[model samples]
Target: MRKMALVNQKGGCGKTTTAVNLASCLAGKGRKVLLIDLDPQGHAGLGLGVKPDQIEESIYEVLSGKIQIIEAIKTLEKNLDAVFSNVVLSAFEQVMAGVPEREFTLAQGLKEIEDNYDYLIIDCPPSVGLLTFNALIACDEVIIPVDSSSFSLNGLGKLLETIQIIQDKAGHELTFRILATNMDRRTNFSNRVVETLRARFPRNCFETEINTCTRLREAASAGKPIAEYDQHCAAFLDYQQLMKEILREEAKMKAKGFALKSFVEAKEKVKEPMEKEVAFIIEAPEDAGVQIAGDFNNWVPESLDLTHSHGRPVWQKAIRLSPGLYQYKYLVDGRWVSDPSNKKRADNLLGSTNSVINV
Candidate 1:
């Protein structure tokens, strides 16, 4: 089972919404899903129509050693069960603050019931406190929901640092992906934020952006996943695409692991040209003529001009190049800048980081 946590230190990033709807959608695909509410706020349960006052035992009990996980879980949907939490959990951090092995509390509790579900989706609290630490230790993977607002983008680096801390101190390695939520494509500011996030973490960012939709809020307020509330709603469609992307990525990773030899053989036998098409993107004024400069074109600034993609604010260009590592940057309206989506970069002699791409 893949235990995935939707975590973000910043608030109002759609962590609960993604957890509720994503869990429901996965369950709709016939996979047994357990949505664990690790937050003290308990919105996960409340959003699912699970009354806060009605739930007797929650994840708080499980975390506190007062009860086992199964005792606290309640089946909400056909293929989905929830381990809810509430405000009482706010005291848990202080209670467990003095306990030994505190960071592994959540991990230890879930380990006993590991086989009960095909996937576990955890809704983490907004703060990077003890609860969030436990989630990090317990989860096999993390999906950081970053809002499209410019300010929220600043938290991405900090969360990545937290994951690095887990890797260093806890000795647990985890893969992570970024989901851009609350994206308003109609506004250039939001679109630019999304593009910048994609450019900074190209390998980790999901291609499917959860565009802003009022139906998402309506579903939450009505105590239902978008799928159950209004299947035809725009929110439902966006989440459906997100679910499909998640499944596809997981399948590809699984195939790579279980069928490594065949996969490699098949890839080698494809006999496709070694040259790859690399997409260079950067956010610039609509009328600004962005050009790419790198070793690929002998550092010529005006060799390749970028154009907007389907009325989007960001400029993009796809160039075919042979298999190799290349250092490149964009000249946006005459000013040079590194690709914001690519974190892998090298410091040039000019004291600027050049984005690195390998094909």
Candidate 2:
């Protein structure tokens, strides 16, 4: 099973929007999807047409050991099931404080139901508190909802630091990427924010930027995923493409035999290679430009421009160079950024690491 969490420490960034839509889209594609509402606000359930009072048991009950996780899961349309959230869960931190192994509570509870679905979409709260921590520990991967706004990038450092803490205590098994939501191309500010994000979190970003649309809100108010509500809508189409990109990335990570520890190691490993042709299948944020530059290129930061697949954002390019290892990063919209796809990374003078990939 591929468990993914939609998280953002900043509110109104569309974390729940992505989770609800993506989970519904996967279900529409005939895949079993479980939407876990880790947020105490219970917006996910409301977005899914499920009333909080209607749910007899919730994630709170499961975490508290009052009920089994499987029992808390409420099946919705086709292959979609959701474990609704309730306001009572807001007290989770205080209640779970004295308990040992608090981080693994959600993980242990999810073991029984993980394999039952192809996708488990978790809608995390705005704050990265205990609830978000549990979701991080329980999930296999995370999709960060970065609203195309100026302040979005400012919170990244803190979010990453929290992830580091969780990695130290729980386990370093989770991978994450930025999923730009509420993107408006008509506005110069929006475009600049996207550019900044591309430059900042290169490898950890998705290749699809979800375009803002009124249909998204309409769909949510109607309590349905975009795919089910209106597949022709731009928002729905963007999310569908994003889902495909995520599946492709997951496959690549699995093929590389990456797990939690080794993956992080791979992200930090950067070295000169002895191969003449270095083929890099880089996973970059959608619409971000990638180029090669290093000692061989005198760190010009733009020696080779990477090309994308025709009509697709998944960037791929092959370069011919001397037989030695090189350090490089993707240039997304003129902003230099590290590659999050590869596990091997090497720190540069700028205090950021260039994700290393073996030739």
Candidate 3:
């Protein structure tokens, strides 16, 4: 089974919407999908037309070991079964704090029914907390939904860092990618942000962006997936394309012989000297001095400024650093912005984050 988590630390970025629509769309394509609402808000279940009061067996019960996953899932929509959530899930931290291997509980639970579905879509809450950690631990890959806004890019760096931290602590090799959503192409700023994202995160960002459409809002209000509401809507088509892109990417990763392995065990097998390189591609403007600032440089400005060697606006700068986890961002004319060029970021208190390169 293919497990994926729709995650983003910021709220209102379409994380639940993407999870519901993607699962429903994939199921419509004849794939068996299990939608797991890990968020305490229960929005994913509600979107699938499952009423809160109607949920008898939920993710909360499954996590607390009160019931088996088979008993918790409710079939919603054709070829789709969902494990809903409730506000009671907010107490999960306190409830499961003393549980042995708390992070691995969800992973173990999913493993029990791993072969029963083609896809398991996990909808993570807005904050990168214990529930998000459980989703990350349980999933093979993660899809981040980012709005085409400045703060969206700004918050991305920190999200990626948290992923790295999880990978380090859990020792699992999990892949991640960013999908830009709610993109308003008519606006110049939105277009510019897309361009900025494309230039920096070419490999990690999806080619398709979920376009802004009232029909999407309508679908949500109606408690129906986009594909079920209107397959012809731009939003529906976008998700279809996204599902295709995701399948293709997964195929490529499998062909590359990348299996889900514990990074801790895997690291012990690697003895080669790590090569470190820092490359920055500026996206804000020509006058932007894209400097690397993060924990590595004590968040100081001018620590790693891109050289304007070519004279013309060559938008990128490269640097080198020691082997360790690092958080950084491009300082564009005194404004702290994430590498729109990169999709991976981590959460931090300053509302800024950086990417991690093992080397």
Candidate 4:
């Protein structure tokens, strides 16, 4: 079976939405698919119309060894079966703490029914905890659903770093694909974010983009996938294209002997130079919208936005620069201001001072 997990430490990035819809679409294609909800919120099961009260035996029971995997399985559709989750699953980390090889609990449990499905889709929790680790250990591939927001872009680097750590510590080889979700095609900022993502991770990004659609949210609220809610909607078409892209990639990989392995290795080889590039950072309120504007690109702030640093109020932008002096300013919530962190200043034509830096 082809196993994959949808993971992102940041919330509201369409991680659960993608997981539920993708699994439903895959199963609709006549493939036997199993979606395992590793999230404590139980949103995946709930998205499929499985109420919390209806779930007596959840993934918590199976992982705790209180019941077999089959006992927790609930048939959702013709070819789709799901292993539900509940709030009690939140206690898994504390409960399994101090146990040897606890990271492999889910992996060990999957061995019982690994042969019964064509695809195994795991919806991981929003945090990088023991439950997320178990999903990582069990899956060979990861799909990171990123939204067209600056905050979402900010978390991408840290999430990649976490994945690298998991690979090194577990001694496992895994590949990842970036899926752009919640995309608003009408806005230039959204388009720019997608362009930035593609430029940063060209080899790992999927060509299919999930556009912003109200029907998608309505479907989730109605406890149905886009396919069942409205097959003719744009969201359904986007997901169908995404499904086709995945299947096509799988076929191409099988024909070329899984060339993506080398693609991932190539990314690792260029990691050092990428990290050494110049970065522009500024301190701003977490609630304020921040962007960098300078002579680099005709002083258009919309062309370059700053991303929030992980767990901090500071925002940053990393860009390649040659050895030269540059002047810039920060555009915070529509007001242009000099960078407080940079002491060096230069007079601009606008009768104001701009922060100066030498690379």
Please provide TM-scores, in order, for all candidate models, with all chains considered together: 0.74, 0.72, 0.74, 0.72
Cα lDDT of candidate 2 equals 0.75
Q: Give the TM-score of candidate 4.
A: 0.72
Better of 1 and 4 by TM-score: 1
- Assess each prediction's global lDDT (C-alpha) against the native: 0.80, 0.75, 0.77, 0.80
TM-score of 2: 0.72
lDDT digits (tens) for residues 278-298 of candidate 1: 877777776777788765553
Ordered by lDDT, highest first, the candidates read: 4, 1, 3, 2
Report the lDDT of model 4 for residue 167: 74
For residues 1-359, could you state the per-residue lDDT of candidate 2 as single tens digits?
Answer: 77778878999989988998888777877879888999989989988888878877999999999999988887888998889998999988999888988978898998887668777888999998889888888876778888885444337656766776676676565667888888899998778767655644555668899998999899889977777788788998898998787666556656777642243344344223544766656556565666755433334455344455765556665776644345667766687777666677765424466665443
Question: In model 4, how many backbone clashes occur?
Answer: 0
Per-residue error for 220 in candidate 2, Å, reads 1.1
